[model samples]
Target: MSTVMVRPLLHLIPTVLIIAALGLSGCSTSKPLPRQTAPPAAVQTDPPAKSHPRTPAPKITGKPKTTISAAKQSVLVSERNRASCYRLQPGKTSTRMIKKHIPAKKAATAAHLAKKDATATTAKPMTTVTRMVTTTSRCQPQSLIYARCRTGIDTCKLGDTSPVQWFACAKNNSATTFEPVAGSVLVLDRNARRGMPTGHPVYVEEVLPSTDNIWQLRISHTNYDRKCHLDQDATVLFNSTEMTASFMTGPWAPWAKDLKALGFIVR
Candidate 1:
């Protein structure tokens, strides 16, 4: 609280010191003293926390349903839209078009007269029908076509089954034909029980020019078991017309070409 006053010399000295210090201060900003701002705290950002994409759901639609009835039953829809509706019916089987019976309009007087006339006529009794037996065409016995089937033996190295079909060399089973004609059908074999073709059917290829060559025929088809082209085996020469074939299988049965070279024509 006591008041003290500096000597004039002492005050003058301090004031000079302050003026010198201020004059020493630079006119420039002094590079803003390198601004000591602190960086943002370690945030723990985790790379923006990756977001996963969501899958889309499927859309649904609806429609009507239909079902069929049982065999004996049928589906039908009726409509009175038409002035006249006709019913469908079955007609004759042999015809290509359908036939129908329609009602006819007539005068009452005429209709009555017709009715009277119909009544005046006497009716005849109906008769019962009797069935007749059917007979199939028979081609066996009339010819020895069946006896001529090949015995698997080829005069030219053709393989043969254990026994043979009728051959010329057979002691008593010589091959022969009673029916010889171009139009007639002759089998390659004479075996009866084995006559049925497993699957293949050998048709008569042709009737050769030679009369004794009835068995020498070309087969339209090879035995199903016979190899390809062998089905086309033809009897170029025939000592017998009754050559028979087993189920279709192979070789021309392989020597089909060889058989052809040997003058056996394709059936």
Candidate 2:
């Protein structure tokens, strides 16, 4: 209704219409922009560690071999006092040395020979047997230094030159026994002799206790050494009753490997 109001309104309407058309055209033709880039962050890091290979254990070694010396071996040998090791027997002297000189036997005089013959012819007759009244005698036949029978002193008769004969004579005189005593006579058969025809008799000087019901003895005998010896080592085996001897030995004798005592004549 007024001219002034009417003019402003017309002008405002055209201006707004023109602005809105330009805005719509710009929006249809618009393009998107590129994306932005960013810098990287810091990271923690460690130096490389040293490396080593595994090792094996050391091997064990064995002990070295040893050898004995000649002088050391010689020191192990027994001395001369222990002669059994050297001779392999008892009551024997060493025979390793050779003699520089040997003494000669003296010749018999002509008169001495004739006188010996006359003494032999005039000698008293020997008794063949001796009566055995007592069971034991205190005599040692070897101490007499003669081969003849020693009558009642020894367990032998006049004609009993060999040990076998003497043993038989003793039995005939009622001296037969199965066991031994301090003064018993141990009789061995010919089989007990080493390559000898006659048997032997040894006098028991002592009896001693040994292990496991066995007994040890010290004996005296003649001709074992071709002479009389007071004592030697011997082992005896007794029966269950202990009244009879089953076996006997003189382990030190040279013929010990083959010889054994058969029985004993006890007093």
Query: Which candidate wins on lDDT?
Result: 2
Tens digits of lDDT, candidate 2, 159-214: 53666676566678877676555555676667523534676666555667655655
Model 2: C-alpha RMSD to truth? 29.5
Error of 2 at 160 (Å): 4.0
Per-candidate clash tally = 39, 0
CA lDDT of every candidate: 0.32, 0.47
Query: Which sections of candidate 2 miss by over 4 Å?
Result: 1-152, 209-213, 226-260
Candidate 1, 220: how far from true, in Å? 1.4
Clashing pairs in 2: none
* Top candidate when judged by TM-score against the true structure: 2
Question: Model 1, clash count?
Answer: 39
